[model samples]
Target: MTPISKKLSWVAAVGLLASGCAETPKELVDARAAYKRVSTGPAAKTNPVQVADAKRSLDQAEEACFSCWDTSAGRDKAYVALRKAEYADALSRNAMAGKDLEAGDVQLASLQKEYLSGVNARVAAENAAAAAALGTLGKTQAQLDADRAAAAAAQARAQAALDKIRGKLTQDERGTVITLPGALLFPTGKGNLTAGGKRNLDPLMEFLRTDPRKILIEGFTDSTGKAAFNQKLSQDRADTVMNDMIKYGNIPADKISAQGMGSQNPIGDNKTAEGRQLNRRVEIILLKPTN
Candidate 1:
């Protein structure tokens, strides 16, 4: 070939190479770097299949750039490749973290077992020492008997006090509950206590003033109106009762609470007038002492 012709061909080749290099998308570059990092790191050993999938995606990106001459397609495939590499790396990290967590859990369980053993040993020693002291004193049995008698007397007194108050009294898991009909407490669709309502509550309030039991006043409504209106009305009535107990009954504020159980826990069918009357009632719950 002539010298000039050879030189021209070389120049054209250099230009093509420069253009190809310049046109390499940023996504492809980033994907190549990510794949290199993941493939050479721990992910390659722990998640080889994921690494291989990333490699295939990278290959497709390269193919799109060179063969298809589509920069957008190439970028999409490269992004997929980058995400796959990152996912593989994340999986490896998560697996390692899980192993660490499992090891930590095993260590914690061993520590707890050792602590419990020590605690049990100490408790047993204390019990044995107490038993010996009790045997020497000769009063442990007598003290226990006295405590049982006192507890029984106290329970009887409490029951007697509960019986003295006049209302529909019942015992349940929540303690002694006194149900007062809504019609007796307030005018229809109103929160203010009626004159008779105040009188009706006087006995219960007097009992609460003497007894130091915690009180929970729950106001309920029948399904006669919009639920929202009923809920607000019930809440207002409960709050008013709670305020009265605190203000007039001289009950400690901290020992009393109130809530509106809007149209819930119906004791009677809502369809009937009698049932609805029963459903719309306020309950005064005398909570049992926790101590």
Candidate 2:
């Protein structure tokens, strides 16, 4: 055998000989799958916060890789890259759920906690190194203070802009569909879009038209009534929004599509009045990528 081949075979034999009884580690397998999924999965609904979160995780994962310190092997931070990408996809779905989606509780909570922990760990490590480098004039301290101030200002502006966009659905957010508050959209036990609801949606239609993109208007209702009847009512409501888009927004008929998802995906607890309200909603989905 070639010298390198013999060395690799010896290494593999030693690794196996030193191991304890082994089955596949579920965590490792699951994590690897998630990583691959994020790298390859089709674009689904997502939002800015989720997008940012995913990217942060990915960056962290990449940085964690010891192999990344090397220039050859054509390798990236494989594990870290995977985790961050999938985490971002998860975040997108979580934000779309708003206050209603219970399924996102575990993932969203875990992500926030992990992110904070990672940030604290990184800062502590960096601060220790920086402290060791302090010179006689304390110029390093001054520079750090200035950097903090600039970062804080930038963060404030970013947060404000995010808040503005949160109330409205961006194309990324629509990938994770969540029913909006039914109470806000219509009266109790009614399928009709109230005048106030129509007024509120006026700005949304305008937003859609600004980009000349196709929209899918979906209507959903609670499961309190007959399924067949609710389906038709939901369709009718979706039609109402399409009519508004055509008449008021001047969007073309072919550019918009409408459907009803009556009682199929309740975003919140249907047992409570508030939850029921959260369940009934008109979702505006984008058919094509938008700015």
The per-prediction CA RMSD against the true structure, in angstroms, equals 29.9, 43.9
Q: Each candidate: how many clashes?
A: 0, 8
Which residue pairs collide, candidate 2?
Answer: 45-175, 45-176, 46-172, 46-173, 54-88, 58-84, 61-80, 182-277
* Model 2 alpha-carbon drift over 4 Å, by segment: 1-179, 289-291
* Distance from true location, Cα of 243 in model 1, Å: 0.8
The estimated TM-scores of all candidates read 0.46, 0.39
lDDT of 2 by residue, 1-291 (tens): 999999999999877754522332343344456655654543234444544454555444444432333322212343444555666667655555664566578788999999999999999999887777666338767888877876465445433433443333333545523234555566765666688766655655545565444678888887778998889878888887788888888888888888977787786677998777667777776554556
The numbered model that scores best in lDDT is 1
Please, what are the lDDT tens digits per residue for candidate 1 over residues 94-128? 98899999999999999999999999999999999
Top of the candidates by TM-score: 1
